[model samples]
Target: MPTLFSKYAYYFNQLCEFSPNRLQAQKAKNVAPVRYPTPVQKNMNLMVDFKVENKVIGYSLASKQHAHGNCLVHFQSTINRILKPDSFVVPRETVAISICNSFFTLGSSPTDFVKTKQGGKPLPEDSYFTYKMVTKHVMIVLYNSEGAEEQLAGFVYYPQLLTSRRVCPNIDETAMALARITYSSDNGPEMFARFCKKTQRDVIVKIMNGGMSATHMDYNYILLEQNYGSCSECNAFHQEKMKKEKKEKKKSITEKAASKSKSKSEAATATETANSTVTPPPKTAPPKAVDSDDEYDFGN
Candidate 1:
C-alpha cells in the first residue's frame, strides 16, 4: 500500500500535468454562436485573492510581470488571509484560482497594446505569465509545481494546437494558447460544468448588454466551442453598443460637416452679393484745388 505522503505526491504530479490549461479548452473543433471574433484585451489587470501560509492577500495584477505589479492590498491582506510568510506552502487549489484570476485580469504588454490587440508574440511557458491572444481576446494562466488535488483543486486540459499561434488563458506561452480549462473539479463535475457554463453565459450577457463589436473571426470561434470553447455571449452587449456608437459618431460628423459647409457657402455668397451691390467711389478728378485758385484770381 502506498503511504499517504506518496499518494499525495503522485496526485500532485498528475494535477500539475493539467493545471489551468487553455490549449485544450479552445480547440478549433469546438465553435459556438459567434457573430464575430472577440477582440483580445491582453495584459489587463484581474482581481485576485490568495491564502499563502496563514495570511490572505489581494492584488490588481498587470500580468505576472511581478516587476511592479504586486499590490500593497494583496501583500498585506494575503499575509493575513493566507498562512503567514513563515508558514509552509499552502495547497495548490487555494492558490491557483486566485493567482490565475490575477494574471488573467492584467493587460500589460511588452510592446504597445496595438500589437497585442492583433495577437503578438507570447511569453515562454517558463515565463511567470504568458499573453495568450486568440481571435480578439486574451487571458493568462499560471503553472504550479505543488499541491494540485481533485479533492479541492481541478485538473487542467492542455492541447497542442497547430493552427493559430494563440488561444485562451495564455496557453501560447509554450506553443499555442488554444484554450485552458479545468479538468475534474471537486464540487462535482456537473457542478463545475454548470459553474463554467454560468460564468460563460454571464460574461457573454455582460458583453452583449454592454454592447460588444463583431469581428472577422466569428466563424472560427463557433468552430472551437464544440470541444474546446463555449459559445457564451460574453461581449455581445458591448458589441451592439460599440457599433451603435460608431454609427452615431459617423452620423454626427456628417451632420456637423454639412452644417459647416452650408455656413461657409452662405458666407461666401453674402460676400459676393455685397461686392456686386456696392459701387466704387467715382474717380473724382483733382479739380477742387484748381477751382479754388481760379476763384481767387477772379477776385484779384
Candidate 2:
C-alpha cells in the first residue's frame, strides 16, 4: 500500500512535469515531451487513506484521470469520511437556537433558511438545521438523527418570537413541548397565541413595553419594523381591524352627505309647491259691491 505522503509526492511530480511553465519552456526549446493518451498510465485504481494522528479518518478513491493542456490531473472522490479530533461539532440544540437568533439578527426568511439545507451546497454555520414553514406565521426546524432519519429539532412561532424576543430554550424539552403543541393542529399561530395568552402574556407585555433593556428592545423593534411591517400577530390583527373601521366610518360619512342632499332637495320642492298653490287675495271689486248693499239695508 502506498502511503498518503508517497501518493501525494507522485501526483505532485506528475503535475510539475506537465505544468504550464514547463510546457512553455519546452515550446521555447522546440523540444516536446512525449504525450500519453491519459494523465496516469498506472495506479489508475489508486486509493489513498486520510489519517489524523496515526488513525485512518477517511479515504479517497481516484475515479479518473484527465489531461488539462500539459497537466495530468486525477480526480478523487472522498468516501466514508469522519470528523477530525479537533473539529467542533455544534450541538443540535445550539444550532436550533442560533437559527432562531438569526431571525432577529439577519431578518432571514424561512426560504433563506431552507436554501442552506440544500444538497451539494456548503451549509453556513447558522443553518445546520432545516427550516419548514408550517404556517404563515409558524416555522419548524428539523435535523438528521444518527440513524439518518429526519427528526423535529424545534419550532419557531415567528410572529410571537419576533415580537416578544423570546427564544426557545436550548434543550430537548423545548422541542418536545413545541412538538406536543403543534402535533395535530394546523392553526399554529392561533394555538401559539392562545398559549402565550394563557401563560406568557405578562412576559410578552413586559418585553414589548421595554421592560427588558430599553436600548436592546428599541434595536429589535427597529429591525422588526424594517423587516416585517408589524412584528406581532396582535399588531397585525389590530391593523386589519382599524382598516375595517376606517372603511365603515368613511361609508357612513358618504351616506350622511347623500341623505343631507336628499333632504335639502325635498325641502326645496315643498317650498316651491306652497308658493305655486298660494292664490292672490280675492278680487277687491267683489268686496266693494258687498259693502254698498250692506250700507243700503242699514239705512232702511
Return the top candidate by TM-score. Answer: 1
Top candidate by lDDT: 2
In Å, residue 233's CA in model 1 sits off its true spot by 3.9
Any idea what lDDT model 1 has?
0.31
Which parts of model 2 have CA positions greater than 4 angstroms off? 1-231, 286-300
Across residues 1-300, which tens digit of lDDT does each residue of candidate 2 receive? 579887677556644533334322322112221211121212222323211121211112233321121111000100112123433322111111112221222223221223223456554454344544432223455543243544444333322111222221111222223343434243232222121222222111111232211111011111111111223544444346457878999999999999999999999999999999999986655444457676678655
RMSD of each: 20.3, 27.5
